[model samples]
Target: MTYSGSNYRGAASVPPAGGSGGARVAAAAGGGPTRRGLIGSAIGLVASVAAAGGGFSVWSTANDANSDLDRAFDLGDLEDRPEDTPALNVLILGSDHREGNAEEDARSDTAMIMHVNEGGTEAYAISIPRDLYVPIPEDPDAAYYPDYTGTNAKFNAAYAWGGVNTTVKTVEALTGVRIDHIVEIDFNGLIEVVDALGGIDIDVEVPEGQDTVTSIHEPYREFSEGVNHLNGEEALDYVRQRKQYADGDFARMRHQQDLIKAIMDSALTAGVLTDRGKLTAFIESTSDAIKVDTDFNVVGTAIELMGLRSDDIVFMTTPNLGTGDQGGESVVIYADDPENPEASNPEAVSLWEALREDTMAEWVEDNPEAAGQDEGE
Candidate 1:
């Protein structure tokens, strides 16, 4: 369970190229597909060739997208993460924003903590509710805008108030873990990525209802449920719709995780990693919407992460059951207590601890049914 940073092959001893102090870890560990001299030599060669001719270009263009996205928001000063850390925690923020999306800019609809073990073989993602009440950090140096008020506010508002830095800091304070990277993707990018992959297949447990706008200004549409294959827009609607579900944002988070699993499964089956054109397009189209820490480069990081199989990844929500009043606002509390565990039980914490220690296979062994499904591409 003790992860040695030295075991990772691609992490730069010094700083990575083209970034502040962020280190790029090569993807050779059990995390993704980082086998160097070819386990499947023929396929590797073909993939390499395809990648060089098209995949690499697509990746470069995708980097351009990141550059374009940077113009719209303030990417905080890069944090210098020490190399010896046991796990790399990344805050994955999914925004509802689209082109000229003024209304959606007010909040972050989805948030998840992606914890990748230092060795890179395993990953555990824990989704956090957007409506959770937390204190917004104050920015003393801002000349144009005064510091934020209120002791506690909805978590998503952190992004609207001070952008990524504030959100990251807030989450770090909440989780007691330092985030090594932050990746934010918007609705347009999500749709494009799904489309680039030829649409993702997802299983809808509850039947989907149509969204009929009461007024012309509101968006309206309908969706049929029951394990239907969803295209880009439908998939977006599937994850974004919450009013129909009883749990609202909580249900939406579960649906989002389900969609991600489906996407991963489909991507694996479609051989997206080997398909140079599709892979490049996927990266390029999504690049603009994705904002990562200076240390995280998609291509370089993915290349290092190639060792990870779909089955190796595990996803869960933060253990929470009841609601409470914080600062006169309703909020979900994560893990009320260790002894009398409610939603955030010791089991959930232990699950995360197991993930940080790279002992997730043990956890999966106990839950064979959940582990049995085919991890789509």
Candidate 2:
């Protein structure tokens, strides 16, 4: 499964863009998104290619749109899941390299797991709440991770402690699901990808009460409540908006997820993959901004994902018991039982089981209320 970095077309000799070096995460000004997001560019390219019947050309493009990832990590211990199965778990991280503003430690503003059911034509992009309470594993080299007095902490705290390695480990520990592939996208990647695609159009919906609060970004523009179209910069800010909403991070999470959905929808309907000039621009920017594990075989994946499309996708939120007081800090606790927190219920276990069996639609069918939607214009 090991391959040289040179094997990847877009990533050859290119410095890894997302989570490269001492890259810290920051949202739009005024604590916009807590730190980082979803795989806007990468997801866009994959779905667009599939829709356009890219075939060999898309395979080549996917192989080339690459990133440099750590090759030595041990996935040997991960629960063995058959490769032939339609189920594929990909960790999608959106990171930013910004110097200032608020959060001392870099945290992923957005985190999502894309579960692809290739054979079934059913896929899910589930948002892992950054604020969900979880145990941050002890990492000797992780400086940003706090030596917290308590055992459990926020989910994004794993990234702050040990970057991608810690985050991936934490995800496995919490969800009991092994990630098969990783795609890390940076803020610049999102911007450049949108710009290269001749700019993306996502419907912006700032909550009802954002008229007077004012934006911290330059020009201090306020996001009006409606279906406003966005470019790269505007798109970034639109998803980063959390302070204006009552739900805070939850609202931001939905918006970020919506952005990913918007990109997928746009890629399918907008003809980016079929159009040569736009496709070239998309391929270049996407490759430049993202990084994938060395084991990721893009050509094979493109072939497997032939029939996957935007309409087939479903959005979800990790089951939770809602927010509560934990260790003195308000946190989102795991829902063993949503109504009765006293019972020893592990909601994720069943969800993970469903994912393993490639029956997520069944899980969704069982818990309809747990799902989230973009509802963006």
| RMSD vs true structure, all candidates | 8.6, 8.6
**How does each model score on TM-score?**
0.68, 0.76
Best TM-score among the predictions, by candidate number = 2
**Candidate 2 residue pairs in backbone clash:** 10-64, 36-109, 36-110, 37-110, 67-291, 145-161, 336-345
The window of 10 residues in a row where model 2 has the poorest summed lDDT is 23-32
lDDT, residue 256, candidate 1: 76
Model 2 alpha-carbon drift over 4 Å, by segment? 1-35, 44-62, 66-86, 99-105, 118-120, 141-150, 209-214, 335-346, 372-377
lDDT tens readout by residue for model 1, 211-329: 33111113555554557787777777667666666576666676777776665565555477667667656545555435455544334344344334444456556655556776577
- Residues 253-277, candidate 2: write the lDDT tens digits: 7777666656655555556756766
- How high a TM-score does candidate 2 get? 0.76
